[model samples]
Target: MFSFSDQNGFCGRRCVWVNGPVIVGAGPSGLAVSACLKEQGIPFVVIERSDCIASLWQKRTYDRLKLHLPKKFCQLPKLEFPEEYPEYPSKKQFIAYLENYAQKFDIKPQFNECVQSAKYDDACHLWRVITVSTNGSTQSETEYICQMLVVASGENAEGVVPEIDGLKDFTGEVIHAKDYKSGEKYAGKKVLVVGCGNSGMELSLDLSNHNAKPSMVVRSSVHVLPREIMGKSTFDLATMLMKWLPLWLVDNILLILTWFILGDTQKYGIKRPSLGPLTLKNHHGKTPVLDIGTLERIRSGDIDVVGGIKRFNHTSVELVNGETLDIDSVVLATGYSSNVPYWLQETEFFAKNGFPKTPFPNGWKGKCGLYASGFTRRGLAGASADAIKISQDIAKVWKKELNHKKQKVPSHRRCISTF
Candidate 1:
């Protein structure tokens, strides 16, 4: 898939020198890191595969998608959302904010450049990044050399759909949430929503609002919560509570509150896991859906909540609870893969699940000048903090290297070079 442009054909290799770090992806994570580097007056080249930045928010998300967390928590390092923005901004608003952030920071990423491979050269004490650029039928290759490589492709780089039995044979229509834009196209159709994550719940609600019959296939246990309780944002409350109380105590309080508000999920056949929603999120990084109106819709029977999918037939899908229903289309909100294993050469750097092995800010540091960011599952705030720390680490290395280089040069040469 890698190609280089040449006078003769498309296999030429050209070296592009980057005096500082080489960052991958121009999403929030990449831009956050770039901003931090810019603050320190560091020179880095951000390589984005897509034509524009923040492609996830720009392209993958549905038309109705909005930030689950408040705008304050979601803002990048130094930049803040407009005062006129709502508590939660829509997908487009967030993308526009990122665009503004990039422009404000003067982060001009090299667009349409897909990273082919990155390898560390211990002999040269540098990292090699090979990128391929494609324009129609033409392809160009550029090899970049830098002391550091930042992988900010984010956690959800690739969509992951579970391998359901007989899925490929189903004839109606199949699509992942990544490709789903709006429910207008699916109005009046019987849709089966797979996975009960935030995307799934929100998508189900969107379909219901558009007059589509959505039957959600809950494959496993999940946590659901109202977007607010007692006029306070649940996320905002949880963040504050975690700062003061122990996790176990916080879990119990949240459970009690959820019971008082939403009552028993089992009444509607939604299996609530033993672990508290916040506890589960902190431990496994799986977030509960911040129910806006999805719960009310589900409770009112506007949407049908079903058990795990057993299998699929041509015209219908069977549930594990021995119920079968005709489905006109299937929309998978099954989330995404970490995408770290595909690029990094060092297998030890990844976890058992194919995600990067490191955690939070530490995970930003990797083997052989390679660092992974935006995969912490901490959302925007976490990514921003991690990016800042990683940039600080890089700055330290850059300073030491500069000092070493200065020491290596003869006094007369150093004095002359200063001019």
Candidate 2:
């Protein structure tokens, strides 16, 4: 039990007994935390905003999308993907795996319940969570109190739409990458894909396969590398290279190596921009189309690479070089922004980009128990790192609470006494 005193008197103090912790978001990070907590026999409730687990994977990913990392490295801890699955699981297979994981652990999250806000109550030393759920005709808001809060909401919650001038006025359909699932919807349409990221590249390929006649809008030069370099996974190769060299040196070396392996993309109207991997700052490192059968399609004049969209009208899109393209729809794969709205307004503990500040010392010491995971840039291995760190911290806090409870026993009541 914990109590916080008010200025009125001892009678004004509010006491809250520890029940269990609350985990917000049911993504990979949240599921990992829930598994760890369940293993420890710690009571917890996981809240998800969607109707199903791994909804983002099912809803937001485009067709032909595959895991950037190998299957061996991308799976949750203690759960191995079956050998029947491919080297890189597809969106549908990944979602099925998550379903199996949840079912195996008996982790049934309360879905369709979205968290609106959470605030710490000093008087009770607990976090009060407010959630909204739709109930047929009317909506209802429910509240829950917990001793701690774990925010596992991923960084890509809010889709980013590039602020293009006069975009709204264009009559053609405009869609973000989140709304794009398959190229089937774009059959026989003239599609202009904006951005040169993985989503843009893969979506263009899928569209071309569906006879959509898609054109890619390249803003700047992009570095294209094969998904596997020298018969190994790209991630594995990058890890090995980075281990022995500085980041800059490693990036330069990889760039040179890729250029030698894959001829200059300039012949296809694509230029090599970065020397290394595509990063937040350097968005130019394009993954090699992985020879996933897309190369032959490109060589057949199915996919056309064009300059960036300088401006657009109802029926025509003008390129940066004054070239014009008449398209039926625009698919913007501009990426996502890191925004956690619920707690950002009330807490000063967050990054400039709105992610929660990590390595919370006081919260750890006092057992206040607020922590963030999966916001760091460890690529596909980020979720794993977050799980390890969060589990260690939770264990420390749980031990401290148990010790405090044991200390409350009277000396005479001890079963075994030490003289």
Candidate 3:
């Protein structure tokens, strides 16, 4: 139990209380974790920054976006999307599904609540979660002390705006992929899309379809594979191969398979770089941007593929190779950067880029009780993977605590087997 005190000088009163695990961000990953905990009869509180769960899908995604992977493999365990839904759910349908999932599980998360800071109390062995809720003209602060903390904040929240020279002087409207919604706004306008990721490619196509005359600016080579290969979804084939082959070998095979299915990308002035470690991390495995017949649109002069932006004047953008083009707007399909805003500058739990360095032990490290999911591109299955891993990790810690209380055993001796 905790007490609340009101100070006349402060804006609002604070509520202090002890609770179960505190899960932040109500995307698919957060909702899935909450569902799992519910099944285990574990009490938990889910905090979301938006008014509804999966708001990214509902708000940020483009008009024509659909899940790249098939529904059978992309859904959460023991949960099935509606039979009426297509094999590849559209962004609208996906958001509805998430809402349905929450209702089915009776997961009434505290919406409009944005987490400001989460800090661990060494003395109490509990996590203190501070949040701000804005509704109408009123704003309130709340705090929760929980035994565990799960960060389900998906990687898409913070848009990764690249450092481009002379961008600020361009005088044109510039927005990141997270701010893009529909192509209708850009209709009859010339739009430059940076990056060849799914957002870049899909948004370009969407804009073209809406008569926007969009151009894609590619800096690095991209591997554009067909949605299906050999009568099977490319995701299924990749999953099968990854199970048996090393990453390098798997990439080679995937590239070879893609070549036969989608043809080489080099013909369109786009080169496929050497397959290195896939940098685009999502829980779905790998971010697969389906060609979606956009190549034909590019060939027909409906969409232009340009190199990276070097500098931009008020009305024109110069490419790295010195090529210049005038554009009405610039949509940075640039991707996103991870952030742990609550941590202090001197905190050893975070990397220079603000991501936890631990969970990815070999290439990741961070403090215990703090975890991030949906950062690694596992693909359309990423949300499920994040949920599974976080749930398992929390269960392990919870079991250890329970055992210590019931059997007088050391936490180390009572550790739950992750395997």
Models sorted by TM-score, best on top = 1, 3, 2
User: What is the Cα-based lDDT of residue 185 in candidate 1?
Assistant: 87
Predictions: Cα RMSD each: 2.6, 5.4, 5.4
**Model 3 ranges with Cα > 4 A deviation:** 1-11, 276-288, 341-349, 359-368, 396-419
Q: Give the range of the ten consecutive residues with the poorest summed lDDT in model 1.
A: 1-10
lDDT of 2 at 223: 59
Q: Estimate each model's TM-score.
A: 0.95, 0.85, 0.87
lDDT of 1: 0.86
In the range 382-413, model 3's lDDT, one tens digit per residue, is: 56766776777677777777766768755565
Q: Which 10 consecutive residues of model 3 have the lowest summed lDDT?
A: 276-285
lDDT of 2 at 107: 82
The candidate that wins on lDDT is 1
lDDT of 3 at 65: 83
Pick by TM-score: which candidate is best?
1
For candidate 2, list the clashing residue pairs, or say none.
223-286, 225-288
- Per-residue CA lDDT of candidate 2, range 1-419, in tens? 24343345543323233367777778887787777777776777887888877777877777677886789888886688889999889877888888888877778776887888778888988788767776467665656678787777776777889888767878999999889878898899999989777777788889987879898887877656667778788667777877887777767766676667766668887776535553422332134334354444566789888887778888888888899888899999887765566443345556566465444222211236676666654443566567666777777778788889878988676556554
